[model samples]
Target chain A: MWDYTDKVKELFLHPKNAGDLENPDAVGEVGSIVCGDALKLSLQVDKESGKITDARFKTFGCASAIASSTALTELIKGKTLDEALKVTNNEIAEYLGGLPREKMHCSVMGQEALEAAVAHYRGEKPPEVEEGTIVCQCYGITDTKLKRVIKENDLHTVDDVTNFTKAGGGCGSCIPDIEKILKDLWDGKVAAESAKPGRKLTNIQKIAMIQEVIETEVRPLLEKDGGDVELVDVDRSKVIVSLRGSCTGCLMADVTLKNIEKKLKEHVSEDIIVEIE
Target chain B: MKIVYLDNNATTRVADEVREAMLPFFSDLYGNPSSMHTFGGQVHRKIEVARAQVAALINADPEEIIFTSCGTESDNSAIMGCLNSMPEKRHVITTRVEHPAVLNFCKTIGKRGYRVTLLPVDKLGRLDLDELDKAVTDDTAVVSIMYANNESGVIFPMGDIVNIVKSRGVLLHTDAVQVAGKIPVDVKKQPVDLVSLSGHKMHAAKGVGALYIKRGTRFSPYIIGGHQESGRRGGTENVASIIGFGKSAELAGNHLSAGNSKLIELRDKLEFGLSETCPEARTNGDTENRLPNTLNISFEYVEGEAILLRLNEFNICASSGSACTSGSLEPSHVLRAMGVPYTAIHGSIRFSLSRYTTDDDINKVLDVMPGIIKELRELSPFVK
Candidate 1:
């Protein structure tokens, strides 16, 4: 059985805004009966104020899918179209206290429907059906959607891509394609970093930027867990750090190091590597 | 809340008699049957008695039964054992709707340079005998098919399969885990080369199964260890589970006719009642040839996991072939092989009754199922 949270169970049993809205400004539908889950989202928008007054959905899916649709509608109501568009699939999953990893595609479906609805409101082509090569034949997932989902979720593996987007989950013939896409994505990230405007940084400037990133980005997150990181040295692209407080000798210290390295890579140089002192 | 369980195809409640028979082995009789001393070695006699009881249920000789860990092991052993004995033969044949135990093993073997032919089933989940006949070749090592599908409860024509594979001069194996207890299986009457049976499916405890290798069938042991089962299956026996399996098999053989009648009555009641109450519901298998205790029905528009959750609210337990329930992106391969419409496939629910199921249990399902399906359908966008 799925380890559904109580909030998910409560919402699934008695979902809010479960019916289609009458004469809505925009309607977005995604998935299909063949896919074993589908959702039709309707929004009642106040055009003058550019705000969504109401949101409703009719879904054909499992408990998690229904709960995800309900969460999507509840999260988007009373927000502007732009604000609603910013509601990521992760936020919808977080709203449900997190969905099972395999069922993450349900949240993705919810987000897709919302995007489709907003695009419809703007009288534009739905982002999902945009021109792209079809990669997953079973699910009809396209390469564009796969790339976007991979970037949004920071997905590194084909299995993670399947869980998030239902790509490479069926027949699995597109596994090689998914693997190529992931390789290209991370590889392109490194290439783009090299080609970035600030590829060359003075040693003093690089050290200052690293300290600033740790103080502003990495340290706060560590501080939340009653741990900290102190910069020990910066040799070339390598940033040596010492763990403090609860972080020293912690089992998750390696994971913490990876997080610090990821932060440095994002804010400083892509070649930044964090090592424990 | 009184629990109503209708997922017998998945597993069953260990019978009271089977449990009681096994209790002594866990404590007072905790001795290795291979030990030299009488206190430890005498338990081998009880194990032999168990071997006899399990053989009697299938009408095979006691020496033919080789105990294994579970049905999956029995299946793996039957196929791998056959292939190992006949290394020159590189082909295997099976049905697409088989349980993953056989299907996945075949797929893995296929990657290892073995030619595997997966026969397709019709819309009713029945195989074409002509296709099976054509798939067998001189290089075919073994043709392993299930006696009954776990999801649809559709019985294969094992008698016909035996004749076809036998005439083709190839080994035939049947995974009879689901059919062994619910249906009467007389090995003498329908002579197949190998047959697999699981204990838990027949009200025995889990972790014990038996594979019957007919006399004069050349085979190799899948598990190699201490000389056990007369050098067929090795490793120390799962003592308590084997004892329980023996008791359950003996009890199953005695109660087959009466229990089947009760199961059929309750199953038909649930089927007929659901059809009457729920509109646009369709059954998913060969209705005429299906097992008496199993019903696979699909409700239109509503998804099965939602219905199952609603059933959970009423303390009813059932299972679904819907993709969401199984954590897959597609409905059951059995339903897909049967060509069930997508509109109904997501809503497929499999309710398998056992001898313990009562008319009142059927009534609880009938009483509450319509309201749940109706509510979910109301929430479904597919509903017109």
Candidate 2:
């Protein structure tokens, strides 16, 4: 059994507003059968009052999706259109207790549908279109939103963007887009840093400085912890490092290496490689 | 909240009498049955008694019983033991819908240069005996068939199958896990070379089962270790669970006739109520040939998981063909092999009754079923 919360189980057992509205003002559909879940939501918005008078939904998915849809309907019913637009996916999940981490997308889908329905009712185009050109094809995320996310979250790699927005993880077709976005952010950061005095250095000089820092600062600390690190070849500003001794088999080796890399990047160049052998 | 358990075909609650019979072996009677001391000798004698108890239920000799870990292990031992005994024989026969325990083993042996023919079943889950006869050849080593399917509860004609295989001088193994306690099975009357039963399927504990190897049948030990099980299956005895199984077998023999009729009546009542209340509902397997306590039905349009969730609200426990495999989106392989239509595949539910299930339990399920099905169907995309 998946350790479902009591609220999730209650909503699954007796889901409120679980049928299609007869005369809905707007119908919002999201997800698909191939994606493992789908939803069909209908809303009855009062034209003069700009308020949602009724909301109903039909979900074809697992417990989390069903519960999220049920809660989403209850959250928006009898609420003004402006208030409905302010509802977030986190709020939806919290309404039905907390959803499992992997199932957080279920609540996110509810928020997406609600936004789409409200957008349709107000005769305004969906905000996702006005956001900008899509940077991640897997999730259809726009470049402007991705840039804002990268700046706000301080993401440095393609994988970082994937962890934040689930952009480059699926099929890896959007990897180049993720890389371009990361490089753009890094270049912008580097330009800002170089504008200050005593921070600018050539690429080759930066690599040498990083290597010296690892051997002096990083290697001594690792050796004290009964481990050793060897520097491998550096290519295209990516340093490869191989761990030895106790670190070779330890579960914490990856974490330790990542922390050292983060430190080296801060002191040296942000684009410098700190390879572990 | 009361938790009702209706998934008896999956497993059963251990009876109190059986548990009491096993307590002594776990505590004061802990001894190695193979040792030469008086303590070991007494424990060995108790094992003999258990063998006799198991044999009496199946109408076989005590010497013919071989203790195994579980039904799947018993199945593997029987199938592999027969193949090892007749190394020259290359062909094996089995059904398409046998449990993965048997089906996967057959597939594994097939990869090792053996000819395996998987026989098909009708829409009602009955095999064509004539097709079985045609599949047999001079190179056939053994024909292993299940006595009753776990999913559909449809009983195969093991007697006729035994006659066919025995006439050909080929060995036959029948997996009687589902039918062992629910129905009467006498190995002396049924012409089979081997039969398998699990204790947990009855009112005994898990981790213990018995395989009946008919006297004079040629076989080899699948598990090679100590001289236990007459050098056939070698391992330390699972003393407590084996004793519990012995007590369960005895109780099963005494109540076999009465339990069958009463269980069938309750199962029929539940089946009729569901079909009458829900529109376009129908049974999945053969009515007359199924286990008395098992009922499989497909409620049109509504998915099984949605129905199960609604039933859970009322604390009415049961299982579904599709709901059990929730993470995976594929329909059941058994239903697909039986050629069940795609429209009805996701909507199937299996309600398996046991001796413990009462009339009130069936009535409670019947009371909540119609409203649950109607509500789910209204939300279903397939419902017209």
lDDT tens digits, residues B205-294, model 1? 999999999999999998888898889989999999999999999999988856577778789889999999999999989988988889
- Summed backbone clashes in each candidate are 0, 9
Off by over 4 Å in 2: A28-38, A44-54, A60-62, A71-277, B1-3, B88-90, B110-115, B323-327
> Model-by-model lDDT, in order?
0.91, 0.80
Model 1 lDDT per residue over A174-269, tens place:
988998999798967764754433658899988988898899778977775557999999999989999996576555688789989998888788
Looking at model 2, the pairs that clash are A239-A275, A240-A275, A240-A276, A241-A275, A241-A276, A241-A277, A242-A276, A242-A277, A243-A277
RMSD of each: 10.2, 10.9
In model 2, the fraction of reference contacts reproduced equals 0.14
lDDT of 2 at B326: 43
The DockQ-derived docking category for candidate 1 is acceptable
Candidate 1: list runs displaced more than 4 Å.
Answer: A189-277, B257-259
- For model 2, residues B1-384, the per-residue Cα lDDT tens digits are 766678888889899999999999989999999999999889899988988988888889999999999999899999989988888999999999898778878876775578999999989888999999999999999999999999899999878988888889899999999988788898878869999999999989999999999999998987789999998999999988998898899988988955577888899999988889989898898888999888889887666766777787788777776522343334566776787765566678888888888988998898989988877766654454
Q: Which ten residues in a row have the lowest lDDT in candidate 2 chain B?
A: B322-331
Give the proportion of true interface contacts each model preserves, from 0 to 1.
Answer: 0.81, 0.14
